[model samples]
Each structure stands twice: as structure tokens, then as C-alpha cells.
Target: MNIFKRTGKMALGSRLRMLTAKFTDDASSIYNLYNIDMQPKWFPVFYVLSERDDVTITEIAVEIGHSQPSVSKIVREMAAKGLVIEKKDAADGRRNVVQLSAAGKAIIVKIQDQYQDVNDAVEELSAEANHDLWKAIEEWEFLLEQKSLFQRVRERRKQRESGFVEIVPYEAKYQSAFRELNVEWISTYFKMEEADYKSLDHADSYILDRGGHILVALYRGEPVGVCALIKMDDPDCDFELAKMAVSPKAQGQNIGWLLGNAAIEKARSLGAKSLYLESNTILKPAISLYHKLGFKKVTGRPTPYERANFQMELKLG
Candidate 1:
């Protein structure tokens, strides 16, 4: 039974493993034809050693994109087979370096024809298909580096969960909730300064009454997140996106993202041209979210809070 055929893309890792196993099996047979005693799995490390001399296992692992332990095991096996020599590193006594032995160098000369034949075969195989699997794999690796499959799936999940959340305008009943949420979040990461108290203690008088807006996220009819668009007097920006916080119990459901988007739209609806924010660099996830929301760092703006180390601004039409 072909489990991958039934599982489809969900079995991608398994399918790749199966294909690699087949390739490795064929490669071992090919090595036997050349009278070479080597495992197919050691080919990457062996080839790396053939090109370089006196390389550490960590260097080889990085070069071949394998783990240090895996590379170390292969180096030991090669040393056992008399194909490579291992010695303590002169610069670092704790580490060992490896290089091709005389036998290993001779094997490289003997396999020059085999390497050429393999390359030609790979080219021919790629040409036989309309879509080149080799090129596709390279492009896939590049894309995965930019945004992995895990992140892509997580985004989809966030999108699904965000639909269940409702962004509502500020209400009198949620006044304390807004204050508590922000206070809890801030106190968890930093001390609550006077500037924070001035806003949280009287959000309505300081924010809502002064041509600003506040957004609250409701999950199951309960407030789980909040963000404020405080009207700014700066010449460069119209509003400051401040006091964003999400409840720990309702975290990971994209509540912060939803509230942030809602707050931006609220500001834009109020004829805002740009938005600014103040935050510390220690809040990496929040900084990343701000970047994702199209915010860019800017200097020369003096901060009111001692904890704020960076300021970001988002230009809006």
C-alpha cells in the first residue's frame, strides 16, 4: 500500500525520506561497482574532506548542513576505514580535526569518472521532466528559509482564529479591563512608570476625549485584548499606537494582531496620515509583529519612558 498516495502532501517528509532511501540504496550499489568501501550516508562528509584539509567536525557539519554529532560519527567511521586521519586540533586541544588519508586521496582520483557520470545522469534526469525537481528543491529551500512551513501553517491558523474575535469600540464597561490588561502586561515585563499610569488610570479623559480611539477585542463576549490610538501632536505622525495588550489565557489566538489592525483602521478613519509607537527592544515578538504590520524604526524622537529604547512609525495614506 502506498501510504503517501493516500496522505498526499501531509506525508511530504515521509515521501522525501522514501525517495532518499532509494537514492542511497542505488548509490551504495554504484560504489560497489567502483570497488569502494563506503556508506552512502558518509558521502557528504567524505566529499567535503576531499576538498579541504585539517577541518574540524563543526566546520564540516556547517559546510554539509549536518549536525556535529552526525559529522563526528562519519569522521570516526572514515578514520576506522583508514580513509581519513583524525588528530587533535593544534589551536584547540579539546577539538579534533580530520583530513583525507592517503587511501582517501587515491579514492578521490579513482572516482573522478564516477562523479562526472553522476552529474551527467542528474542533468539528463532533470531534463526528462517538465518541472525540474532539482531546481524546485532549491527554490523550495530558499522560500522555506524566508518563511517556513510551520510559520505558514501558523498564519493560516491565526487567520481562522481571528475570525472568531470581534473588535469593538471603547465602552464604559471595559474601562477597568483595558487598564488591568495593560498594567498586567507592562508590570510583567517592566515597571509601570508615571506615563503608563497617566494613560491607564484615566484612559477616557487622557485618550478618548482628546481626539483618540481605543479598540477592544472580544472573545466569547469577554474582553481579551486592547489597543489605543492616542492622538499625537507630532508633525510627523497623527496618532500613537499605544497600550496594546492581550490576556494570557486568550493568547496565541491572534487577538493582538486583530486589535492592532482595528486600531490602525480606526486611526485612518479619523483622517490620520501616519502612526507611531514606542517600545523596548527586549519585546522581540511584539517588535516582530510591529514590523509585520508595516512599522519601521526611526530615531531622534525622545521617549517619555525609561524602558523605551526604540520608536517605530508606520506611514499610512
Candidate 2:
């Protein structure tokens, strides 16, 4: 009788909806058994308003990951139940600010212990699934934030079709492209340090002339990506993969991969025995890509850049 369960993976969305409905129904039953007079769907918005008083509907929507209209509807329901109060913003009368009413505050005190019990029950249920459902859900949400489902599907479709994303060795003509690419990423994530300015302003003398290598990626004849292999002062044949950047418009097109591989190949050609890089943990997508390319985390070392929190190395094979 459960059509979605019969369809298996083919009905992922339907199955997920069914699972959510089951959980919601069970939550409703639990509330009724405990004499709690709140709906499961209103919990997110209610919790947010409880913590942040007198916030606008837009703020509640952002905190709860719902649309403003959806949050407004929840607020209306809570207001009808005498659980929330809405007031017109003094500065902007058009905006409606929401806060928990005295009844809602009292109810929170009444249901605080039950909330913890419900969370514990959720953990127990998740544990019975034979996999880390909470972790899986977290990863899924992270991936969705990195790229929407529709965008990822479209990218895969484009990858199947013929396209031109070319990685070329550094040329004198691409001097500005190299600087612009690196500066764009560096400035966005971290501030421009003295070393960054040195490399960006004098790529030829600081990098190319000093036996370092730079690779540039071109898409449709426009320079869209670049990565550098900076020769170190150490005695060993090691290179630092640094200053990698891809244009926002050309991202998700494998341009970073092209430039990264090209940089590694160039490093190897120049007798590099080990490749290392300094990056921040905030760059999750970039760090994931580096891991896929066989880079592993190593102990932290003193670095000139204050933003560097992670130092990873890839042993050249």
C-alpha cells in the first residue's frame, strides 16, 4: 500500500515527504499526550522569536529557513493562539515585528523539559536507521547551499556536452589576468597582505623569473582561472600551490580543477618531490577539492599570512 516505499530510490522526494509526514504526525501525537498545545510546524519560528525579541517577519523567515509569507502565516496562527504579539515597526510602519507573548513565554517554561525529551527521542530514532542520519542531513544541507539541486543537475548536463575549458602555461600577455584572478579571491576571503601584493604586482619577477610556475585557465578565449606553484627556499624539492582563483562567472565549470592539475603537473616537471598549500577552513568547497586531489592535512606551521589555519600537503608520486 506504500507506493513510495515500493518505488525505492526512484521516489526519493515522495519518500522523504512521507517520512517527514510520519515524524510530524508522531510529534503531534506526542504533544497531545503531553497536553502541549503547539503545532510541530510552528516550533522553528517560535523558537527563533523566543530567543530574538521584536524581530521583523523577514528576520524570522531568514532564521527559520522559510519564506516571509510562510513565517507570517505561522505568526498569525501563534497570535491566534495568544502565543505571539505583532507590532508595527516604529521606523517602518509597513514592517511587522514579532515577539513571544506572555502566554508563549509561560508555555516555553512548561514545555522546556519536553523539548529535550523529544530531541533525545529523535536521536534514538536516528540511531536505529543504521546510518548517521543527522550527519547525512547536515552534509546534504551543506551541498544544497553550495549549489542548488537544479543548478547542479544543469552543470552535469553541460559537462556531458562538448565544451572548451583550456589550461595553458603562463604567458606574459596574461599578467593582468593572473593578478586580477588571485586578487579577486584573496580580497573576498581575506585581506590583501604584503606578500599577496608582492606576488600580484610583480608576478614576472617574483614567480616566473624565480623558477616558479603559474598556470592559467581560459574559457571561450577569456582568462577565467589561475594557479601558482611557488618555489620554496627549503633544500628539498618542494613547491607551494598558492594564489589559485577562478572567476565567479566561470565557477562550477571545472576550471579550478584544470588549473590545479596543470599547476601540479608543472611542479612535477620542475622536479618537485612534495606539494603543499596553506588555506583556511572557511573555504570548505576548495578544501574538499584539494582532498579529492590526494592532499592530506598536516601539522600547522608558522606562516606569514594570518588567515591561514590549515596546511595540507600532497606527496608527489
For each candidate in turn, the TM-score is: 0.75, 0.53
Q: What digit string (tens of lDDT, one per residue) describes model 1 on residues 1-317? A: 37777888978888889889999999999899888888998899989988888899899999999999999888889889999999998898998889999999999989988889889988998889789898899999999999999999888888888888999999999999999999998999999999999998898899989988888999979999999999988887999999999999988899877888888888878888999999999999899999989999998888889999999999998
Checking candidate 2 for backbone clashes, the offending pairs are none
Report the number of the highest-TM-score candidate: 1
Worst 10 residues of 1 by lDDT: 1-10
lDDT of each: 0.90, 0.85
Each prediction's RMSD over C-alphas, in Å, is 4.2, 11.4
The C-alpha stretches of model 2 lying farther than 4 A from their native spots are 1-155, 158-162
Candidate 2 residue lDDT tens string, 1-317? 37765787657777789789998999899888778789999999878877888899889888778998998899999999999999988888888789899998887788888889989988898878899888999999999999988897777855752168878888989999998888888889889999898888999889878888888888888899888888888764378899899999888788777677778788778778889899999999899889988899987567889899999998896
Error (Å) of candidate 1 at residue 125 is: 6.3
Clashes of 1: 0
Clashes of each: 0, 0
